[model samples]
Target: MKPELQLSLQFADARHRGALARHRVARFVRAALETSGRIAVRIVDEDEGRTLNREYRGKDYATNVLTFDYEHEPEVVADLVLCAPVVEREAAEQGVTLEAHYAHLLVHGTLHAQGWDHEDDGEAEAMEARETELLAALGFADPYARG
Candidate 1:
């Protein structure tokens, strides 16, 4: 049986209000998840993103995406935070569409929530390969691919 999914999305940055649709994000999350549970995706400004990163991750700078996985096993529960400004900047720098970048991040975060990691070379390679496959299945290009 397919796992059940409960997804909630919040856009704290109004500047990118219509940049991504809820359904598209849901699709990406669903595709990347191995099991189902509640997942919250929030789009925030750099300030909030940086604050969260500093407090939770000890990083002073805002990042493109942050995943907070609360549970993984019988069910998966997590929160994914995306810094709108950082994401936009990176998307432009990478020459990919905003939606595509968001999709990639959603998939990446979902995988993290599912207990996937990249702290080592071998793990990173495996995770990237899975991400590439999932993105391609979703009709997006390999996110790690460079021009």
Candidate 2:
């Protein structure tokens, strides 16, 4: 069953605007939803991404994705921030399509919004397995797979 979702897609960085269409972003996010949710997916430039990470996570560099989860009960509510440059670079480095990488990140972020974490070995394994399963269901290859 597909979980109900209300998604808000924003692009602070227009570089990847053509790549991230509203319906496409919604599809990626919805694929990871286990329950009804209100999620905002924001695509930002390196500057904004770096600032957000520095402020929120005390990290000095731009990251691929950041999840600001507010609620995780009957309905999940959260904001997912994706750094365009970082994602693009990582996709190139990993030899994957930009869309594929975005899908993986969205699934990973959505899971975090629902309280999934990888702080430990066991948690990391479980979360990665779940992500791989969900991505596969969406017709994506295992994100953690290495050749």
Candidate 3:
């Protein structure tokens, strides 16, 4: 059974107005959740994305997705921030659909909120395996598959 989720979605960047519906986002999130959660997912433009990344992660550029996880027990409480333009660029570069990319990132962020990480080779492999499994279950191709 999928874990219960209370999701609050926001689109600071209107460019993705019709793309990321609440049900779709929730489906992506729930697929990676091992516990119930209160998650806020925000989609932002490059500037806001860069600013948040710079302030929170000390990185000067916008990243695809950032998970600010506050809790992992009983219930996971976190915020997932996705950079829209970056995601679009990546999808185009990777030859994947925008919907597929969004699903991948939401799953990635949800896993992070549930305490998954890819800080090293072993961790990365495991995390990727998990992500692959989850994505496949959702009928998506392996995100890390080599061409």
Candidate 4:
């Protein structure tokens, strides 16, 4: 059996959009790593997303999600900050289901927390392929699958 992991989901919005998706996320992450840890997912707006991405990654744009891997001491404490607007826009433009897209991004972010990066072409290919397989196993469509 996979180890126990705790998750906390926060939303900057007044509604419960992320709350609806939390269980899927928890299932995805836990099954992927098969480890014991604590993770927090925060759904934020553009401003906060931009600020954080800039501060931590030195990127000035508001990306979909930023994963902060605080520690890897078995009990992991990481933060996944997702921008709602960006996610929605990407979902529509890419012609993917919101739930499937969300699953892909969450898996992508979790991989980052586990020391995966796509900084170069070789690394990008490897990570992207891994993400594709993981998403498929999670019952999600391939995010990189073109229509």
RMSD, one per candidate, in order: 1.0, 0.8, 0.7, 1.8
| Per-residue accuracy of model 2 over 66-131 as CA lDDT, tens digit each | 999999988999999999999999999999999999999999999999999999999999999999
Model 1, total clashes = 0
- Give me the runs in candidate 1 sitting further than 4 Å from their true place: none
lDDT of 2 at 9: 88
What local lDDT score does residue 65 receive in model 2, on the 0 to 100 scale?
100
Off by over 4 Å in 4: 14-19
lDDT of 3 by residue, 1-147 (tens): 778999999999979879998999999999999989999999999999999999999999999999999999989999999999999999999999999999999999999998899999999999999999999999999999857
Cα lDDT tens digits for candidate 1, 1-147: 656889999989966768778888889999998887899999999999999999999999999999999999888999999999999999999999998999999999999999999999999999999999999999999988896
Q: What is the TM-score of each candidate against the true structure?
A: 0.96, 0.98, 0.98, 0.89
List runs of model 3 lying over 4 Å from the truth: none
Clash number by candidate, in order: 0, 0, 0, 0
| Candidate 4 or 3, higher lDDT | 3
Candidate 1 minimal-lDDT segment of 10 residues? 14-23
